[model samples]
Target: MSTTSQLAKRFREVLLDGLWIANTNFKDQLSNVNMEQATAKIGSLNSIAMLTFHIDYYIAGLSNVFEGGKLEIRDQYSFDLPPLESEEQWENLKSKLWKDAEKFAALLEQMPDSKMNEGFVDEKYGTYLRNIDGMIEHCYYHLGQITLIKKLLKQKESV
Candidate 1:
């Protein structure tokens, strides 16, 4: 395969790791999570609902970039998920998450290697490769937090 194709494949792999495969994928971590569990908190940390929204927020924002849209996300409002008060709401969010993940992965797979090496927005924001890789890392980091919080919530219920 050509170098661009190879880079695109690698990018897809990283996106898959973030969304589905890497042992600690978001899908697996979120399995069996009820709306109540998702909104539960462990101490001062964010709830699973908030964390999930936070993850999707950036993915959606970056996905916009790849779609030729302007970057309109603000970090300060990243965690502002609508209240996940009903099972229907949680399920809707999950549906949106899966759709966004798949669309984001497809966008990455279609990216040219040259574009990946170019600045994502401005020189200060860094290359698309760096931003994509950082997104993978960010997902894993928050997945850990999600798992731990879920465990703590279970423990609290048991006690």
Candidate 2:
């Protein structure tokens, strides 16, 4: 394979890995907690469900762009949940996330390395790679947040 194809393959792999890490990290934290506990905020940041939603928020934006849509943000969906209030709501939000992740992975698969430098600018992130690699890097950074929160939750649970 050409170097470009190799890069794209690695990028897609990382992108998929980020989604898995985010999902697993969050689930690990919320595992022991019941609906009542999961609903509680982890401080001023957001609840576990909200953080998970935020991770989905990023992936969803990438999906919109890959599909030739524009985005101010993904949570603009009429029923977006910033903070799910119940177990049923969290599970539903998670289900939507799974669908988004699957579609996003397919987008990654179709991407051509030639498009990596295509160039995109947003008021928020500014000019960027216009490639899956950059998006994967961004996703993993947020997944790290999930890991941190999960660690704290585990510590608390044991105490």
Candidate 3:
């Protein structure tokens, strides 16, 4: 497979359906979590919903760039999830994440391998490959946190 195709596959593995790395994807983990559980606090760590929004924030931002738009995502507002007071809101967040993830993967797959060596946005951010790889790594890092948080919430419930 081409590099971009491989990268897209890896990206999907974390957010959508592949079970090679963590044995769990965001869709699987977030599917069963209700609004209360998603927004529940587990000590100093971010809630599941917050993490979901955080990742989606970046995914959507980068996707814009891939679609010929500017890179407009700022780190300060990445975690700025709107009030998820109801089940409908929580579902919306997950739905957006899934949709954005799919879009991001599709964009990546369509990219030419030659573009991978070019700088992403500007020279300071590194190559396109670097940024894409970083995103996959970032997702896995947060995915682990989400998994642990779910376990902790489950443990708390049984207590």
Best by lDDT: 3
What order do you get sorting by TM-score, best first?
3, 1, 2
Model 2 Cα lDDT, one tens digit per residue, 1-159: 744455444544443432343444333444455555545556775555665676677778877887888865744562255655677876776667667766776675666655555665454554334445566565566557656766677777799
TM-score of each: 0.88, 0.67, 0.98
Q: What is the lDDT of residue 151 in candidate 2?
A: 66
Clashes of each: 0, 0, 0
Clashes of 2: 0
As a whole number from 0 to 100, the lDDT of residue 34 in candidate 1 is 92
Better of 1 and 2 by lDDT: 1
lDDT of 1 by residue, 1-159 (tens): 644455444444443444444555677777689999998877799999898899899989999999999989999989989787799999888777777877887787777667878888878889888888788778768878888898899889999
Model 1, 111: alpha-carbon shift in Å?
1.0
Model 3 C-alpha RMSD vs. true structure (Å) is 0.6
Model 1: what TM-score? 0.88
| Predicted candidate 3 versus true structure: per-residue lDDT over 27-141, tens digit per residue | 9989899999999999999999999999999999999999999999999999998878899999999999999999999999999999999999998999999999999999999
